[model samples]
Target: MTLLAENYENDPIDVLVGDWMSEGNMTVRAGTKISGQVDAYEPTFLEALQPALPHIAKYRIKVAVNAGAADTKKLHEAVTKMVKGQGLNLSVAWISGDEVLPQLLEAQKRGESPFENICTGESLDDWDFEPIYAQAYLGGLGIAKAFEKGADIVVCGRVSDASPVIGAAYWWHNWQRSDLDELANAFVAGHLSECSSYSAGGNYTGFKDLEPLGWENIGYPIVEISHSGEVVVTKNKGSGGQISVNTLTSQFLYEIQGPWYFNSDVTAILDNISFEHLSTDRVALRGVKGALPPPTTKVGITAKPIYQAEMHWFMTGLDIPAKARMIETQIRMLLAPHLSAFSHLSFQIIGSVPDNPTNQNAATVDFRVIAQARRAEDLAPAKFVRPCIDPIMCAYPGATPHLDLRQAFPKDIFEYYVTLMPQSDIQHRVHLSSGESIEIAPPAESKVYSKHQPTQHTTGNVVDVGSFGATVPAPLGTIVHGRSGDKGSDCNVGFWVRHQDEYAWLQNLLSTSFVQSYLLGDEYRGGRVERFEFPGLKAVHFLLKDHLDRGVSCTSSVDFLGKNCAEFLRCRVVDVPLRFLARGRI
Candidate 1:
């Protein structure tokens, strides 16, 4: 809400769109409802809207959000009551019918095969878990319908992240569903804006260049979609953020699986994108192609929860590596007595001592032991805590466990299941402020799109790195910028250079083999490495297969969402051109 107000402070914002429901968050909400919570909708929407209520009417700003989560009707009622209580005449609407757990279970009972996991090709029966919540990803038609009914605020359950922008554009232009080109453009705009400050320099790999923008109050993004599908992405003037080709390009590649970005409404083919610099803090995007959407919609299901617990031990002062190994040996010996009690257990030593460390904390090593079990009682804190504490007397010198024993307590871990369901089976609707309801019919059946191939970018002329004169071993950030994110278990990192002349060298230097070499050897080299390119943007993108173990809900990786993949890659030492390093402030 504070960010929204900052956006409107300079000029009135015509529309506001927010995406509060992520894969893990949806599962969390489902657990809440399964535990018998009547109103399990997200409350953060109201928390944000309360402060914006005053300016909403004053600026005539319309708001749309996926804050409805799994309970659209309840959220609608809550927002309506809040609006009325404030004596504000705001028209509100909610899009419903994303939940489909009952429908799916019934279908299975009728002898239908279980849904297959899109990434792993595993059927529902293959999972050793039971479904607790199942919801399909809805599109923008319902939101457009609500806007047509004069809704000032639109709330939705499980809509695609980009649906709000598509809906807003549809309402403003009164576009038909067949407006593929225009819708595709709006889709790109929404994708760029969906992550808020991401499109306006937050989390950008080029933060060194954005230092002048005063990131303490980084501005959120504002996209203006023209009638012909052209988009100008910018932030409020004088706000503390940057909107540049690099910033927007970083967002453009965020979380995308391939050249094809699938939404419930359309398949946006981002193979060939063109950008025009409209002005400072603004760029125009064009040439994005679109195709018919798949006959099925993606669904996220939360399965029965498992119990997990962790114990952290610190090895201080001398011989850190040996100390860590000694502690691990003793702990494993202690746990060997009850090995069968745990379904999974791993010991990891994460921190390392620096050369001639000046402080004890710097020289200290952090060793973590994480365990998972089927039963909560099997993972009781005492089972691990007692064994861990008993080692202090005979353990390495100055060995100590974490003071906060709360980390030892077992916690429920939810599993995220991704699958597809036929769109025709869903019953979608829109509820208006005037108590009128409208049914949203499913789209005509269409063939599902086949997998997309990466765009083959021509690497202009093969430039020799030696021609750039002297070189320096520096972080990759000194010469290039990129963004990284996850789609299912895969990790994608897109790197780009600012100058066109450097593209050839960048393409040559960032091959799969080169990337694996910098990953600290084979431990990070388990997956297949695929690379793609966007010459127009001077970017090379790499996708590491199954790098996350599983998606966020179940991944044991420290960086579950893969947001750190690119940053880690950026820190890897590379032979950077002396000229580029001279220009860099890092």
Candidate 2:
């Protein structure tokens, strides 16, 4: 491709990741377009990938067929029989929609077309697409639009798992369109191998119960990188997942949904990467860390900008979930005596979950109810669910109403959770104008992410908040995901520090309103934080943002979901002063 990028030049890019699990939008290819958040049957090229798998020559990879369905021609004849006997170079890398849909239907029967025809969209039928698999998200803009079309190893199905090492660090080095800390150390070594079975140990909820965990052989993490974005992890041979250093420090706290999951231009500090199990599945990651935004990619962020409105109701039963939870707590006590009627009505109790012990009590319970309103008929839980099913045929005798309440489906749910904050935090444009900035080789790692300390997950940088939860105690392989499982209510628990000027004053006095108004009370007047990302500029992250308004949310997501969100945000910084719990809304 440009004669193998003018023969080698910067090296390092034999990447070949392929993760697939499909069912929907599989129309092979032709100028492909499934806009508005894309996903029209995608996955291409399997091997023969040669600027060199030419361990040297053997070529011949073609694959045809277009009009997809049936796992898009079996992920295109299993990647053309996995590039027949691997000797590939299919005229060097990228090409798949079953080998570019018979050369775009022989260039539209020889009209020598310009382009624009491929179609394939459908499957997101609003939430639960009933999908067993559906992949979309491909970022680094679809691997920089397949290396601007001269391709180089990029099969797909679901990307944005920190996109193929931020598309091999923005295509063969010299990378940097404004280095948000080297694209956040390549998006923190691709969010630790984007769910390839949680860095080789299989979604480890800290081994909640894993017995020699084979689970149909779970293995997948492999990120041997280093254009100085230094990552190591590793895996492939005899796969089955199980790398250690505490299973890669609990795979750096899976998903970590809070403190901030919003992305783009880096902030994933996941407790600053710096692992080292060296032997057993080989975990190294030697510093993926981040932070240093505000040189101006733009970030004023200190959040809480909501408008609120959320609703849901889906009931069915014979016992119809205790008569759909007494018609959802008497429709929030009959819309709380009509507060100027309908400004707010909140209630939630979606049932049938005991992890389905045959639906735990003979299966079949859908009394899902979620209501919130600043007015929308105060979130009509369907007018108190059809006058409580004729008093649920006089229920409560042995609780009846299981299903068939005249084939129920009665639906209505309006949404809103918007919270805004965009005044600036990341911005770097160097699109290469003013004559390639007089020799722009200055960024491949810019002397290893311009040193702000990235040792993978730890080598001690301390930011401790004591009584745990904001810890960075280092050496214990110091890796925490969301980078410390995204500090919402805090979790990388402690690394004892005295300065970076006490990080925004220990993050707004550990989320103030004068220290959570003595631990969440007095109409709990404080709570609102924008996504706090981290690839680890040596840690400092937080997220206990829940902006509870109207009424009730005081607490009980299992006494702190994940068995103790950093000990209830470190027992509000070691107790004493948090006496306010007279009524609720923490």
By lDDT, the best candidate is 1
Candidate 1 residue 241 Cα shift, in angstroms, is: 1.8
- Scored by lDDT, model 2 comes in at 0.37
**Model 1 spans with C-alpha error above 4 angstroms:** 2-9, 107-114, 445-447, 452-472, 516-520, 523-525
TM-score of each: 0.93, 0.26
Give the whole-model CA lDDT for all candidates, comma-separated: 0.81, 0.37
Which whole-number lDDT from 0 to 100 does residue 262 have in model 2?
27
Error of 2 at 219 (Å): 40
- Cα deviation at 214, candidate 1, in Å, is 1.3
Per-residue CA lDDT of model 1 for 64-111, tens digit only, reads 999988788889899999999999989999998899999888876785
